[model samples]
Structure formats: structure tokens, C-alpha cells
Target: MSADILTFRPAPLSQADAARRRAMLLHPSNFVPASAPDRDATEKAEEQAGRFDALYKEFLDRGLSANGARTEVARAAAREIWDGFAVQLRQHRAAGQQMDANVLAVALASIQCLNSVLPRRPEDPHHAVRAVSTARRRLQYNGGLLHRLHPHRNPAFQDAVATLQSLEVFLTRPQQHAA
Candidate 1:
């Protein structure tokens, strides 16, 4: 008597299924493997975190309170972000391209960061007023261009404009009292 034998084979994936598999493999969140770009981005983020930590530690060593040290670190980070945004703005201007959403997003972040760190009533009100006014003018000018190019983002720019106006008023109040 002869014994019966059976072999199993899997069916080939369709084009759509194959494409989806490839996407899953390339995705950064995939557990199978990490892509090169993902690794690089993660490394950069880790390095930045390390630098910020070191700065915070330095502030602590200088005898600043925990809250004060945190504020100082935030201010340092905001300054760096603002400087990078300025460089990008210059590059975009040189290329004669309107500032895109990404650039405007950075400007908003910078403005928020500066606002968070600024005291409600600064000792030197004039300097603070000047800085706020300058930022407001730049944002308003670029925002107008951004609105023409990308109308959907009008609300964000409008909110930023309103914030700057309030901040300007807040900063100038001390001066009015002094007069």
C-alpha cells in the first residue's frame, strides 16, 4: 500500500497587499525594524534633549530655584528656536518664496515662548514694548502674505495678531502708570 502525502504553499500577495506591506515595513513605528531617517531623527531629538538637560543642570548649580531654572532653560530654548526661525525667514526671502506654513508655525511658537517667559510687568518696559512691536509688525506683514497664499490659516494668524496686541498693551501699562 502506498501512503498519501500533501504539501502546503502560500498564495502570492496582490499588488495592493504588497504595497501595503512595504508601507508598513517602512513606517517608523513598525516593530520589525527602524528606518535610517527615523533613527537619525530620533538621535537628533535625543541630542537636543540632552543639551536642554545640561542647561537646566547648570542653572540649578547656579543656585536658581527649580521653577526659576526651568524658566531660564525655556527662555534659552525659545531664543534658539527664534534664531533658527529668523535664519529660515532670511533664506525664504532670498529665494523670493512666500513663507510657508512651517515657517509661520515656528514664528508662532517663538512668539508664544517669548510671551511665556516675559514678566507681566518688565523692569524695562520700553525695551519689552519695542521687541513686542517689532515681532507684531513682522508677523502681521508675513501673515498678510500667508493669508493670500494660504487662506485657511487666517484664524491662526489672526489669533497671533490679537495676542501681540494684548501683550503690547500689557507691556505699555507700566509706562503709563509711571508718567
Candidate 2:
């Protein structure tokens, strides 16, 4: 037997191959098939809206003003979304698998939502602004990396970016006091 050890080196993927791989990784169909019926989608959306309306009505019944009820509902929803993301992140880490782009997008969006609902500290009004600014910078950097890797327009990613932008706007606005 020869003393030399042979190593196998795979050839670089062609552009078409790269594109196909990216599509496989980033395609929405991987989670929910693109061919899913429109009726199912509509039903799911309507169900979610109904749940929100029920919760809002419940809060109103509890004697909260409409604005207060809306704020409370937003906070609760944001908390739930953030908690779900945390669980998914933990699961992915436990499995030693790289996070899917969609997961990252959802997590970022959840963070934005949570930030928007968080009550600013009277003593440190600028704290939220600074924190959100830092987060936005980091998110933009990572988002750019994800875009480069996937080389596709992901609607989830776009929505997450938009959510972050909205959070920035929310942070800049003066706090509204309930009269």
C-alpha cells in the first residue's frame, strides 16, 4: 500500500447549480407549497383576524380605552411572536443546523414588533432609540449577507426590513399620553 493519503475535492458549483441550491434553500415551498390553494390562505388569514378582534373586544370589556386595548393587544402579540422565535432558535441550535433565512426574517420582525410595543423609560427616553439604531445596523449587515448568499428576493426578508424601519419611526415619535 502507498503511504500517501488521497483527499477528495469537489468541483465548484456552476452558476446554474448555485442558483438551484439557493432556490431549494430559500423557496417558500419548503415551508408551505406555492401550490397551496388560495382559499386555505384566505381562511387562515381570516381566522387570525378574528382572533385579534376577539382579543381586542375582550380588552375593551375589561374597561380599557380603545387606544389602551390596542396597545395591550399589540404588546401581547409581539411577546408571543418573540417567544416563538426564541423557541425555534433554540431548536435549530440544538440540531446544529444553520438557521433558515425565513426564521431569521421572522425573528427580526418579532424583535421590531416587541420594540415598538415596549414602554419607554421616563428616565432614559433615548435608550430605546440607541438600542434600535444598533439593532437596525446589525440587521442590515446580516440581511445583506443573506441576500448575497441566496441571491433572491425573499418577501419575508423585505417585510422584516420594513418592520424594522417602522420601529425606527415609532421610536423617533414623541410618546403619546392617554388624556
Candidate 3:
């Protein structure tokens, strides 16, 4: 008696089909990743964003239309490109770090909108500035707990403070260009 073995195999897609799949995976409009204040992470995310833009532009040049597949693909690309930032944001939120959480949340949300479609703009610094401003107001009302506390005393606190500071600097930079 011989035993029969079963193997699973999936169907292969054509080049066009595969391209579509990749586009779908990369498109993102609402969900955006947060890149915190680390230079490396921020730079890496920025690089990926540029790549995403190039890919989307090529897709549009292909057959993708703004009102059709292109829009979806762009959204996917945006979400996937910045996916790393989400993890950092979630961690900060889990740690109950208000300033970090708010800053990242604002940045991510703003960038998503800015890059969602044609005439897509770079992540607006205004969103980040607004976030920090709101957080500062909260801190003032709450007796400036973060300012009073020493970051060096706690590693996590130190990281959170550093991130907030860096994010503020990043946000404030665009205004210089405008002038």
C-alpha cells in the first residue's frame, strides 16, 4: 500500500496582475506611520516616502488614473512606506507619553492628507507645530510636569523628552523656508 501526500500550490499571476497587487499593498490614505524624532528613522522614512512618490508617478504614467487605481495605489504606498512610524507611536501611547503621542499622531495624520492625491504636498510642518503648541498648553495648565521632571533620571523619560524636542525642531524648520 502506498500513501498519498498533498501539496498546496497557488496560481501564478501575470506581470500586470502582480503590479496591481503591489500597488494595492502600498497604497495608504488614512493610516500613516509615525517616524518619531530619531534622525535615522526619520531619514529612512523620508527616503521611503520619496521612493513611494516615484513609484506612484510611474504607476500614473502607466495606466493608473487619478480617479481609479492610482488613487488606491497611492494610499497603499503611503501607508506601507511609513509603516515603521506606527510602531513607535503605539509604544509611546502605551507608555502614556502624552507629548510624544500627540506629536506623532498629528504628524502622521497631516502627512496622510497631504500625500493622499495629486498636488500631494510634503508633510506640513504646521500640523506638527499645532500639535506641540497644544501639548505645551496642556503642560502649562498641568504645571509643566515634563519640564519639571529630569529626563536623565529615567531612560524612558529621557527618550520621550528627546523625541519631543526633536519633533519640535523638525516642525519649526519649514517656517524658515517660507520666509
**Residue-wise lDDT of candidate 2 within 1-179, one digit each (tens)?**
33342334455689999889987865544443225336754454434434555675787799876555555554555455456556666666677746553655544653663455345432342554455455545555555555556555434444443444444444344434211
Greater-TM-score candidate between 2 and 3:
2
Could you give candidate 3's per-residue lDDT for residues 1-179 as a string of tens digits? Answer: 22322334446689999988766754443223334347775564344333334454565577655333333343454354236346767988999987776555544553443243323422433543454444433322222233233222223333333343334443344332311
Clashes of each: 0, 0, 9
Q: Specify the highest-TM-score model's number.
A: 2
Superior by TM-score: candidate 1 or candidate 3: 1
The Cα local distance difference test for each model comes to 0.53, 0.51, 0.43
Say which prediction, candidate 2 or candidate 3, comes out ahead on lDDT. Answer: 2
Residue 49 in model 1: shift from native, Å?
4.2
Model 2 quality (TM-score):
0.43
Model 3: ten consecutive residues of lowest lDDT: 146-155
Provide TM-scores for the models.
0.37, 0.43, 0.28
TM-score of 1: 0.37
Candidate 1, residue 43: Cα displacement in angstroms equals 13
lDDT of 1: 0.53
For model 2, name the residue pairs that clash: none
